[model samples]
Target: MPPLLRLVQQQGVIMSERKEGQSIEEIYADAVHWHVNTGGETIHAKRMGGRFRSLKWWTGSLWLLFFLSPYARWEGHQAILFDIPHRQFHFFSLTIWPQDIWMLSLVLILLAMTLFGVTAVAGRVWCGYFCFQTVWTDWFTWLEDKIEGNPIQRRKLDAAPWDARKIRLKLFKHSLWLLIAILTGVTFAGYFTDIYRLWVDYLTLQAPLVAWVVLAAFIFGTYVFAGFMREQVCFWLCPYARIQGVMVDKDTILPTYDAKRGEPRGKSRGGDEARGDCVDCKLCVAVCPTGVDIREGMQEGCITCGMCIDACDSVMEKVGRPKGLIRYMSEKEMLGERLPPLYRRPRVIVYSAIFLLSVSGILYGLTHIPPVELSVVHERQPLFMQMSDGSIQNKYTFKAVNKTPEDLRLRLSVSGVPGLQLLAADGDTVTLKSGKTIPFHVFLRARRTQLKQANTPVRFRLQGIDKPEISLEYESVFIGPSKA
Candidate 1:
């Protein structure tokens, strides 16, 4: 049987067995009273010390590179730079020009494929750990925690009347939040320009107008979204949240509540005699960043950060019950079905295939990038000039682009017809400016008697004098008098 079909069958069996113990009316009654989190009230989630919480902190810290990358130096230049004016992307030893923009497309494709593949296997790991919104929100809340104390204290402060102490605390927290926001803005702007120079410019009040506008926008965005808006940004602003439904399947693992084990709902006393594992403490909701009650079933608000699982496990430990009352599990697994291996899943297989294909294409494009690009345009007006010496002369304009950083002297030569000579303003050598296309007129003269056909194919070769390895070739037609 197909994996999906088998999973459906197993789910049917589990549902039937669970329902046999209780009537449909009873199940409906239980579900109707379940805790559902809407964005109506302020959720003051309790902070806890746990394994997943620590993992979240470590993973979220990776964003620090964004603030520091602009300061990195390589070969007396920014280590990684996107020089938009010059149409070049410099990465240490490698310099990519507009001619290599196809690689950028491949890179984007690879990233998208990776995200899709991971989403198919595990739901929203990117949003939970690596998303800028989540990371910044974490930082902002951590600062809030430091200034205002725990969740209860924060709630109290929020409800408290405007006193001198409240004013002072609020002012201090807002000031710090604004400072971090401004720093984030400045750091983002630094990526486009020199970080050290930008700091100097800001200090001297000599920065460009665009820089100031970008800084202000970033500061406002970060402060409002990370500090004030918080999970509301994820709930309403993020497009990924809307599209994630299509990427996930039944087998996708997510932080979930084991309803079967935790239902028939009774509170745990000092001993385990009277009820299911869940003590109805609501600690999961207390610790949720989005204030979602995992036991209520999956909802749009859950970031899958596993904070609820951590909170619930701590509660379970305290109440002398086994952990994982809430845990990471697939819908299929919860329904008592065997999950197919990751490679066997259709979505994973398809996404991985596309990911590999995109990677291969990018590698091929990079490896085969030509050092220099050349083109020759045959002058349309008077294609051939009959010289006094009975030679059929052709006027050709040579355009050679020196893509490298240094100016180069190139030697041009034409081949195909016998008894052909090149007449230029100079010898075979011509000077080309670095990163510029140089257009020059060249005369290709051949004895009419030596011409075999009216339009004979010829090839032009341009070789750099400084580096023989840097060369390009173009094929053109060598014109002659029509056969009578």
Candidate 2:
């Protein structure tokens, strides 16, 4: 063949191989690397570094406090403890008893509202950054990434036949996962009991049944959910994901694909000028933890983790194109609509208002938590009896719960019943155990002639003998039979 003919043949071959203006369907066909899971297979999410990735690491670090707090000491006692056995929550200098459980409700409300408000503003920011499920799953995947290489290597290993190398890697990875799971279980249990003692018990194989159960459950959950289930937990198990639709709206910013800027996908070698920025690479799909293509539009499987954004940005940078092929944006912003201020959005305003109210209530409850709880129950079976000394006597039972860590001595007395005399079997002073409720019988006597009504309001007060500032009072009715 002539030289020109040979050159033309080579050019024809090159032209036939050069892919241009690849339709979305063709791109989808090329993306055999990713699978959108539906509870059938494990997802191996590719991990990469970016601004949001660093932010995720920082937020995940907060859970370290959960592990370390039980070891913290406050005046020779655990700094923070649930103390479920004793029915008290100790926080540094403050002790909360069952009487103050109302505060916990406010605390729950505060947390719930905060989650709602954040979701309304930025979709699944918690799932991406702070949620324990997400954090633990990220950690598990990170470990997997380090040990098994990237997602492709992990899948290959998974499909590889049983062998020494594979077994060794699997064993090491699972061993570390189980270690973390056990630590998570123990750490969670520590919050309820003495952490040091709990550790000793576990070491000695003497942990209580409940402690063992908690450890087993957490271990199983962490290993399965974080190590195996990964993002599927966010998809199916989490109620927040389902309800976040209502919380998130057109203004809610999320990891979004700019279809206007990224559509008309083509290949790098094609040089198709009509095509948008996307190169049909599917790097975004490859990097997604949930395997949902952001270009398909926002779906429940999307955790809004921004990994896709990072992946897309990296791809764009490599292609010598401007970044933000996928970016954090709202639907309205994508549509070129001006966004209202946070205070102006009705959803945001309502969420913020409720969040503020919940926070205020929690703060109020914490500040106003009574140092002690006192109750007096008038003996109801007999109401009142006539004493031999020509006085009407009322029997009462006084219960006092000392919220403080130290024992308290209280000078118990009564008033508001004219000519009334207070008497107790244990004398005028009673000692209360720290964080324990003690009940004692008492008597109130008044001259029958001085009694003017069938029911008289009476006041019971206890003055702290050692701590005069710590005092409590209760009011009760001194009842007698109605006049015939």
Candidate 3:
């Protein structure tokens, strides 16, 4: 059976256990009422102060880099630019051409491995902490809470008639949302163009149509998705939530409710012996961004944000009970089983191996990016032309792309074919234009007696005249008449 199915079965048996001789059915007779929210109404999740809340704020602040990085300068150029028109990706001093695009595959693999490894260790921490949608939605809602009111007051205001006060608050909130959305779009586009000029063009309303389109799309998406959709986007729109079920196992640590200690829950009426630690406050559900109940077991709506843990811990403190009714724990730990180390888990081992390999490949590619890319194409229409001197002559084209900022003075030579002679540009030096691919035609002649076969192996070597450290080679065939 699939691991996911087996995990579900094990959790089901755990949840079905009897408490203090009471039957499984009797234990759930007073279970907390829970229902799935299907977008009928907006969930105004109450915010509170806690360790995880502080961690969320710290993680969300990382997005400030996205807005600020485009303005960074390097070597009199925009640093970390994806210059699509020039077909080059510039990262500080390194320039990547189309030929080195294979590095992108390694980058993607590295990201995938990281995601899988993190998911195997902990559940959906990326979604809760670092996802753009989560962070933006948090910002939008925090603004709403400050401008409108707390969750209760906000809900009441939504139901109340539209007054002048209501209109003013709504307008101010949406205007701020639109401003953030516009900045996000513009900053993203700035990575491809000059940000200083882009800002000027946007302010003057002289930006290009593509820029305007990008700005408009981001404005709509950010305003609607972050401001209105909120957790519904994570529940219904984000594909990651759906696939995360397979990534988690019994050992994965997640925000879990300690049902064994918290069952038979009731309001504390001065040392009620029959009741468990739970006070039945329902504060956990109120603070949950996705409106999920921790006692109801893990659900697809859970992003594992740990807001419920904070709420439950705070409530336990108020009632003079021990904290941690809900906390980060694995099913194995909850079931009184020994938790295995990360290295012992097969899933973690495989993901780590792939992650390291991708990192190694990416490092190799970055360190070995060539200063010049060379290609030699032998003319194949006539294969070879016979000279009046009964010599075999071959025509070839040399295409060299100089990736450097300045022009290169390069010298070309031929080898591999015996008695080969290069008759190009009077056998003088060649100039390669900076950051451009230029083609040069050349002729190669070898005595017919020197040619051993119809296709003779040849190597074209290009060495930089000004920088003697630069050397590049291309292998091709010197076509000639077949020897009988």
Candidate 4:
């Protein structure tokens, strides 16, 4: 072989070997790294105390309000009740009827905007702190801790065979969980009906089938999702988790490991010799509720709960090192770039604008809710009738709904052209039932000389006799013969 050709072949072989070595190194590194969590194994995360841990406990306890809110009473009625059968929502002194359902749309918009704004600012704070899955799982795990001890002991119990002592403990824990599940179901159903009356109906086996179905669904869902599924629900079931990536940007702050400072990690000994602060204790992974090794970089399982930060900080304290080995930071900040204020962030600004608009619409809807609603239909069979006295008459069916809580005596009147007279309604008083629409035929008569066109604009006004504040006006066209 020629010397140049041989040298070229040798260089190619060396480069190929280097590429092969790189591939092997990557596979070995991945093997050493803790990757994503699958639902196959039960995660037994260690519990520890720190600022974030305390915050989690406090936020989790806020869910107790959901279980207790149904029992609250005001003015001899459920304070916050959704009377679905009556199509009413009562909140203390305020009543919302189906007519006011637009407010509900605004409310939903407000909630969505708030979620978007918060997600854009801090990633998944709602999931970390206030989500039903997180809160219920926390409660279930706390109960487990009380009954079966910490993560280590819980793992042992899981591995243990069905002995008498194990069976007793397991039975006790399950019984408690079942009770909680039942209570959660009942409380959810209580919101739609009177809580005390529902209890009576349930005990008597007279509750509606729909209510029973809802209770059963809630019970099963709570037991399975909170008690068993736990983090798996966040991983595979929650649609919010899937879409949160789009909502969060690089500016969004999240619980993250400082890779620049912590890489090339080694166990911290008394003597420092070119090593990062990480002691390689694995305490962060041990305390992670989702079994995430945050130091490996952010993963889908990281809920940004800051639990790892708490765990690492406690370990740092114990090892007499400065805290915040794992901390909440934005990508920009982590890359040594300046972060703009929240208002300057485009996502935050847009979300805030939408939130404000939704809130304003809701406020306007609530404040401008009319006391009465009116609809008028002009009779089409015979547009106008010729009276025996040579007068032209028009007939209309008026529907007036009294939205107030009391029955009202309404005085009906019409105004349009000169010489217009109202007939059929005697003494000008029409009775209206509370929350009911009353339909009645009304006739309007006018002299033939008063008719000016084929159709003339007319107004109908209703004034409440008992409560003058309850009034409404509607405009309609009155049909008449065209002038010759």
Candidate 5:
């Protein structure tokens, strides 16, 4: 049978012949009219109240932390700052330096695994609920709805001539959008510098050129991407949409139309028992933010937001039919196959393992961060010198980095060889400047007769004079002449 005839049969109504010399091609074309939005015109999605809509709003509110977190203070400084110029990251009482940047790799891995795992299981819930693009577009549209009115009125206003009322609404909406864009830019820039001073500089127009450039870029991106592009970004720009097919499988549950129950769609009339449950109301298409026709099947534009599910359920209730004409259902369920447990899925298992390992590594690195770093470089040129007193001397350079918040007076000593002595000074001490690496020279002498080998393992110890509990050690090789 032809595709249109098969579709009709699936709807429980099969027509043996076309109407009045109509060809199969014409019949199929008329029956299946799948429309895709290509950004030629604007889409004014109708807003509806439902459980998923409420959930979307709740999740989007989490972005408020982005605007408000920079102002939070901890110990006379911003609570969380990247401090890129100083090569430090501060979070509350803890600080991370360049030497500990490996933790950042683990953090990135954790985030990637989380995204993959969620996509494999739920199918783009992040894009629907928590993505910055989705949240900002929702916000912009909400404001548009409040200022202009419903979708019908907004469309009319756009089509209306340049009248005073239309101009006022457009100007007001754009001004509010620009304000949000500016705030977004400033808040982002505040993460790398002192937010209060940054705000003052921006207000006075005295900020550095780099700061101005960053602000301008962010403002332009936010205003254009969130306000004008809307769902077009998800359709044409997002790489995630292109790769989602590989991430999801038959077991993945998504907002799906029940063809078995909703086929042969027609309006229920007086004593018409042959019609299916769907009333051909098209409520699902009206409420979709992306203008996806769920009845046509899952499309690239579907974000799995579940808005159509809510709309379909509402229509089903109003028409005295069962709910869930559209719902989150996997292909296996549609085909009467049982879905395996999440742990049994290969991708989920791998993703969960990587996610756990990355979290563990990050925690271990953060908790085990050292308070000081030390390295010793033995002098290569003239590694050993014969002193006039018939003693052998060796030169070494010590580089110590103080990671503490305060300077320290450190007493230094050497061990590992008998009859060794400090040629520079006995019981000597050096000062370590806070948050800096300073290099200094140390000389050690040993009696010639005490030399047992050409190379000897030596340990250098640094003890804090004021805080005796602070001790650090570095092991180095002391070079000398061959035993004779």
Candidate 6:
């Protein structure tokens, strides 16, 4: 090493001197070489079974619902179909039409606020466990580990010339990854159409162009991203990672290295009075998916997965010392200060307020979505038509959209002016098909004397014939000649 660079490194770091243990010399030798990932090489992270590892597995498993939900049957139909062609989103018995799409804004807000709140409280827990990128990458790496052997072996294999065995393993691993990608694509398309029928269409080569396009795109993206990019996606591609710094504060809990406790570092074998607890094994670095050295202070690459904590704890255990060389702690706690309550944090308070408001809006929208919608347009060409009986008549275009799953037979009624009558709607009912909008003409007639003014306020109502409780209304105007 250059004397200048070594001096610079030693100036800040507490260096170890003269220590015992079989791995002590090796630790000191490798400690000076540990560096962060710079997106230059594929990080071959070692897999270790631990509590946080198990937690990651469980969180990743939540995505199973994305694959399985389209198969669920409700009232003999796909339970969670988007039905884009019909412009309706079906969720079990609930159907959301285009008019109700405003609720999606609130739903999006709720999700965003949830992510912000969680990030503010416990740094990047979503990115570590729940994010699709992290989850898919985890699965992809697991398959790679099983097929390519441990990290050291894998690195050796990469350097070695590929022959028959290496070729076989690479092909097998890639095939499995491609299969997963294809399944992910199919699952995504299933949400827009019937899952069983979609599969049949694909097998029979009868699927639509849009479905094929979506499937192909998802397949390619999943394969390349999860199989190759891995943590680079989090480091460079994800916009949330860039903004997460703004949401997080000193109070946020993160996987932190206790520098004060572990510095002045040396070997763990003897009670060396000149050194602290850290042995500098670099096992924490080896096991890191993102190759972040936690000892360098919190960097953008840390996903707060606590894998370092698990690794450091294991190392401490092996050295016959108390654990928590690295742990989940706020900066305040790390500095031996009192950790503030959640409500005391301004960011948490703001995020919680937004979250609660968005949730309230979503709930209100869900409960208040009407089963039917109505619109009425008065004729524009001829304002009013004179009837043979000398009663002024006005023509109107009435349109009704049925949002319910069942066909509706509704009785039409008009009200507002005294002696007003429905010239065409007397004892008449309109039959509306499920999820269909239909328009028809209606005529309203009244005496010239009953008009009272140039224009009169008119109201139209559609009451369900069988279910009287379900009704829709529209307010319109009666156009007539101006009063003298």
Predicted structure 3: lDDT = 0.86
Q: Give the worst 10-residue stretch by lDDT in candidate 4.
A: 7-16
lDDT score at residue 7, model 5, on the 0-100 scale: 43
* TM-score against native, each model: 0.90, 0.91, 0.93, 0.91, 0.90, 0.91
Write down the RMSD of all candidates, one decimal each: 3.8, 8.6, 2.9, 6.8, 3.8, 5.5
Segments in model 4 whose C-alpha atoms lie over 4 Å from true places: 1-32, 424-427
Clashing residue pairs found in predicted model 3: none
Best by TM-score: 3
Q: For candidate 4, write residues 83-181 as lDDT tens digits.
A: 888788888767788888988988998999899999988898899898999888988888898899999899899999999989998999889889899
Scored against the true structure, residue 172 in model 3 reaches a CA lDDT of 94
TM-score of 3: 0.93
Span of ten consecutive residues with least summed lDDT in model 6 = 3-12
- lDDT values for all models: 0.82, 0.82, 0.86, 0.83, 0.85, 0.85
**Candidate 1: stretches off by over 4 Å:** 1-40, 270-274, 381-390
Screening candidate 2 with a backbone cut-off below 3 angstroms (N, C-alpha, C), the clashing residue pairs are none
Candidate 5, residue 407: lDDT:
94
Lowest lDDT block of 10, candidate 2: 6-15
Judging by lDDT against the true structure, name the best candidate. 3
Compared with the true structure, what per-residue lDDT tens digits does model 1 show for residues 75-186? 8889878777777788775778787898999899999999999888889989988899989988888888889999989999999999999999999999999998999999
TM-score-better candidate, 4 vs 5: 4
Selected candidate, larger TM-score, 1 vs 3:
3
